[model samples]
Target: MKRFLTTGCAAATAIAMTASASVAARTLDPTKAEDALEISKRVQCGVADGVPAVYHWSGKVYSRVEGEPDRHLFNGEGMNIRQCVKITDPKRGTGYRQVSREVMFYLDPETNEVLRTWENPWTGETVKVMHIANDPVNSRPNYPYSEDGKPHQISTLRRQGKWLFMPFEVPLFYHNVLAGDYQDYVGNKYHAMEIFDFAMLADEMLDTKNPTAYPTVSWVRISDWMPWMKMRGRQGQMVFNAMGAKLKSYDELPKVIKDEIALNHPEYNKPPPGDDPRPNETTWTVFKKMVDKEREAAKNNK
Candidate 1:
């Protein structure tokens, strides 16, 4: 069996910086529709320019059945680390860019142990499992000004001096047919729908000098059963509610989680390099591809 796991806000305070000084501050304006883009960006990253930050998240999954109430499924923990670097000098560049990487793993609900291996009840086959998924390096534009961009500007205009938190919803749907040989285990085609609801907030005032002070985010996901569980066309969905906060260092993670990362994927022990250029990919998409590849290999071997 093949398995894979995949998976901001603003505030105000002392007027140390203004819109002209910070690109994030200048881009915000609740009254203007165009500022929505800036708000989205700032909520995900931060208002500051050229500073790195890390985030830690822990949550649980629930299995929802139509007639019966939802039951606990499993626990999950992950980390996302981003490096925002500023490009100075017209010859080299004159803007800010960010490189980010994330990883997530599923664990036993009761034991809180990472689920590394499992035995298939149907085939009695022992399976090596990897419930974790690592995101590809993602690069995006960053905020440069302190008060000019959306982060700072929105704090005063949008939230009206209160804490700023934004809600967003994302829907995903995709289907693909298995290529060859391994079609017997997994049906010919795979289909699923996932809806994500997110709330983003900032713990402190948006400031350019403090790029490490980024937004904290929480989300809930409603989706089809994970493919690796091999529900065999079962009818049900999974619900996940998780909250994440920026961390000062990797050592801040739980000892168990840190040990797992060191043992299985040591490369992720630290955040990705600032220069990494790989683009992010969806977990579902990657999982389907891996399943198909394994099935094809099995077919060819026979």
Candidate 2:
């Protein structure tokens, strides 16, 4: 899929930096109508001056095609698959000094289990990791929505010729900000306003050039994203301030695309768990304990 926004190298870096500084003390308000052109430019790249070309909102990723141009997965400039990104400061007169990466995934391919891992490569940090196995016989074709009326979507393996492509989306909401399906706290029920399975709090990054810069990024994935809001909601109404400010409303997707792919594609999506379990309960418990310990260390700066 080709992203709607087309970016270029220009004075965007400086403007984003200025905006970042300007909004430093202010919390984002979705009700206010911000400048469309200015928000689009700054959100693509964070507050960075004297740099060329920055990524604003979500980054695109190709569905695994060999020898294909890097267009479908990235913006016009052919960048990498970055979910939410922003340029922090200028460096080397080329790239932004600091940036962020937010990745979301459920279940491990080999194990066919729910897997949650959050990491910040800039600081060599791993925020949180969770694993939940999928039930084969009892597995439903659809994911449950949250109690708050928020939608949920699940991506399962789909066979595309010889390879598998896992299609993911928010349950009822197919917007860009929606990270994963909304599930209740108990892991049993669903809620509308529930948060997504992924969130990274206060990650720090350093300048990647000779002259260092100071910048940081905070991220939160609202698990319950509503697609319908686009038609009814105002443009640039929802503002997100993590790496930078991004307009929550996204271009509507075609119904044809949605109908073709139903819940849980069999090809690329991994099948449900089997009776045979090698990594015994004891091993899994130990792994969870270790991961929990790591998360605590990261949080407390220990």
Candidate 3:
């Protein structure tokens, strides 16, 4: 029901102007299914021993609403290494299977390194069995357009060991308020808006309480491979709930709320380990201060 990005012009400007352009150039464009599949054939999806190599990432998650100050629920710079596998012969000799493993290293925001390691203790090998490639949005056989007839792209992409599910890049940036974009296997789009034209944030970093943190607060702007007018841009706040299917607003949330959303509704929070899960206290402290400063600055500007 939600949208997805496909290889197209949407990401051109952001990727071209940034240093990571070289890597970003490889994203796939679903409009040309033949071309996308061609590229996938060229990719080395298998590891040296036939297992997929794991991919790791480091980032943060932030919270920003109208009246209340913004907060950071997660600030650890961690790694997520995933392994992709395809099994043809099962014990029952019937169905197929795919698997992925994520190893995490949560860090202390100040030092920018690992503070602790958290594994998916609940996930038995069954987690890997559920690793089917998420359905591609662009390739969806059902209703794919929004209410406004805006052309939208909705799909998932996985190549080698890398994967990008639908509507993930949104919250990732919201937590850090950074700007940028990336192309996925299908060449769908992912972008971050640089609020107030402030500094740029990296996908691997999260600027916590430091007033000087990346110096910018940005949200995501998504485009389906459809036309510009048809594309829709979502506020970061809503993206989280869409990804997780259910989430309480900052005001609605209890002072102490554990985000089991990931475990309860993985579909809503498709991107496993949605945003950085740093302590809520830090997120609260930093956001309140930023909002206070921004509110004052707004008055002076007026």
Candidate 4:
């Protein structure tokens, strides 16, 4: 829900590739930041200028606690449609502005249907379920160099035979919008770890002549319970494990996902504009908006 930043499905996953030095030297040198950007764009968006690319993933969500066996809580399915635009700075040289939107649904584990209501095993009470529909999961202008004037470089790129593994681990520890504001001292800041390991053909990604590269993605997320789950601050975390690959068309998605998006989300049919100016959204911020809207409607009725 944060960036290409997030996805999951256990049945959809394949074993991830590991890095190896035995693989021959590649077409584009991974050591170069500009070449790294090309490899990244191929897997994330597309290198061929402005075009929309999509990736879909699904998997199981489980409850993780200190002294107990993890419980299978729910299943999740999600996708992101994104694009990149060329950005140039006299000082920073040329880079890409990446922008996109995404949605993930929580589903019943047994029936594989979207959950409108959930009965917490820990609590006897039933509560409404809230799915993640974060918008504008955009990124800052990414250049080949940083403000400090160093090459915008990266590490941990490994090649195994023909497959190249690009892994991005995003650690989220910002303020939680739903919690109170003394957070800097109170220590209730939002915290989570999202792992996105993309495995693609080394040749395809390094090909400067191509527009994009299709990769198999493995995603794992560990974080707190969603607000709508009504855990009431139960001390536990949720683990989302999933895997999938890039697709050539939206119609390639599962029937359930296609049907749901068609009915509830029209804008999601495509990514946000390349120059979308809105800030990025997370699950907590979206949850706050939902509660605020409900409160306003209830007050008007009163």
Candidate 5:
């Protein structure tokens, strides 16, 4: 099993210096389990009737090798912007929807440049890709609200005015053609597990004075190497440590990132549609799908 590390002292100090007076004024009773859950919900998921928010995150991915110290793989940065909106349709049950769009960038180790285009060894095809995701499914268990149109029940432990560390495991499957003749090609399935440790500030979420002043959250994830790296049969996992804070405006994004987006993917610079369909696709899934489709089209033409 992978181990999750808590936020470093440096990060904690930074938060302390920048935290609002309202945040610093509140006192936490670690023994209050119910309060912990309520705080966790507010930090992880927005409260009912709350405004939409955006979070910006940047971090490094390391290759964790057995018996050897982790090796630096690449840098990553992304944005997750989401909103909770009312849905009048009764059949939906929840009567509210959380629409979101997530985008990630894998940067070159030395130059920190985004790898937007590359050549595929399997098919020798030039590929242009971006890492963006959207999830339109019902809210998760820990979210502030549930699919049944009810609020989440508080059921976790508390520590220092925040919920005790929680663990989340996500299983992902990737399908592709490893190798085969055009007419004899078959799909190959790969499995990976992603685990995360989540924690956040309870006071910020509970603050009604500033609904838009979202709480800060910190997390770490351990998972397999991104398939886009094309490390075929590689032997290592990636460890990602990142911290997120709610953004008041898109302009708050790092100037470097903003410039990059303007030059490379200007379309994504704008906020996502509120009612757009959920995007459950992954980088590997989409790549394999496209490759298979192209091959099939070629075979049919011949």
Candidate 6:
């Protein structure tokens, strides 16, 4: 199981001196749970209430190894279609559930074409590329109250002029499905960090006139080399940095992404149904499933 950590103190410390009460002082209340829920809804999905939205982000993936200069591994394009469902809990209060699916495709560094295979410069071996096509990356219903009956506040917030900056730092640490159970004794574990900074207009979030807030987003990721890379427990990591925004429509994605999704993954063009019930998929889990399928096929043929 992977753990996700976020501390309001850390984020507040970083921008406490800069955050000021924007014009939203008269409208949105940063302290209230209902208002905090509104802020999150606007930044993560939309304020349109029950409407689906699409987020398109693109960036380059890199290789970072000890005693070696960083190398650009591939250019990646990603898109996620999501929607928030309003849920009311008499005991827990008002909240929402975010349901969505996302996909990220790795491209050739120079040509920018979707990569099918890659030659690992470090290991000197060719390996098939497995692009990210995770589905049902949904979130639990978020309430204004914590489990202990405390108010759950969005910790990382900044208000500057007309822009509200909300930075979310998510650090992940957990068991690596591909690694041996002996990992408890050894030291192999899956670890990664993802930072998402969303910038939006305070007015759009507060004013009922605006159906949604189209916030610009910056996404940064640090993690171990993807399993598909065949790193074999190599000493290195992967870094991804990209900028994007909540687009007005899903068709607005890059042509390459649009065409790719249309051909093989047309399902990604829309958000999962509001009542979708399925387990979330991760790269490791998907990779394990693929490996298991191949093994079963080989055994059957024998």
Off by over 4 Å in 6: 1-26
Q: Candidate 4: global Cα-lDDT?
A: 0.84
| Per-residue lDDT of model 2, residues 159-231, tens digit only | 3343322223333222222223443332312222211221111111111221211212233232221122121
Higher-ranked by lDDT: 4 or 5: 4
- Residue 294, model 5, lDDT: 85
Using Cα atoms with residue i matched to residue i, what is each candidate's TM-score against the true structure? 0.65, 0.16, 0.26, 0.88, 0.62, 0.88
What value of lDDT does candidate 2 attain over all alpha carbons?
Answer: 0.26
The candidate that wins on lDDT is 6
How many residue pairs in model 6 have overlapping backbones? Answer: 0
Model 1 vs truth, CA RMSD: 12.6
What tens digits encode model 1's per-residue C-alpha lDDT throughout 1-302?
A: 12222110122222324543554543244444334434444544533543456777889988887788787867989877676655543332244566776677888789998887655444475665656565655766533333334232333323434366555565654344323456556544334443323333333433323433445667677877665666665667888878877666677887777887788777776556667766665565667779879999999999
Model 6 score (lDDT): 0.85
Model 5, CA-based lDDT: 0.56
The root-mean-square deviation over C-alpha atoms between each candidate and the true structure, in angstroms, is 12.6, 25.1, 23.9, 11.9, 12.8, 12.8
List candidate 3 segments past 4 Å from native.
1-35, 38-44, 47-49, 72-74, 85-98, 113-302
Q: Give the TM-score of candidate 6.
A: 0.88
TM-score of 4: 0.88
**Two-way lDDT contest, 2 vs 5, winner:** 5
RMSD of 2: 25.1
Predictions in order: lDDT: 0.59, 0.26, 0.27, 0.84, 0.56, 0.85
Q: Which stretches of candidate 5 lie over 4 Å from their true place?
A: 1-51, 66-69, 88-95, 116-151, 157-190, 193-200, 293-302
Q: What RMSD does model 6 have? A: 12.8
The better candidate by TM-score, 3 or 6, is 6
Q: 2 or 3, which is superior by lDDT?
A: 3
Q: Give the lowest summed-lDDT range of ten residues in model 4.
A: 14-23
Off by over 4 Å in 1: 1-51, 85-96, 118-128, 137-162, 175-203, 207-209, 273-279, 292-302
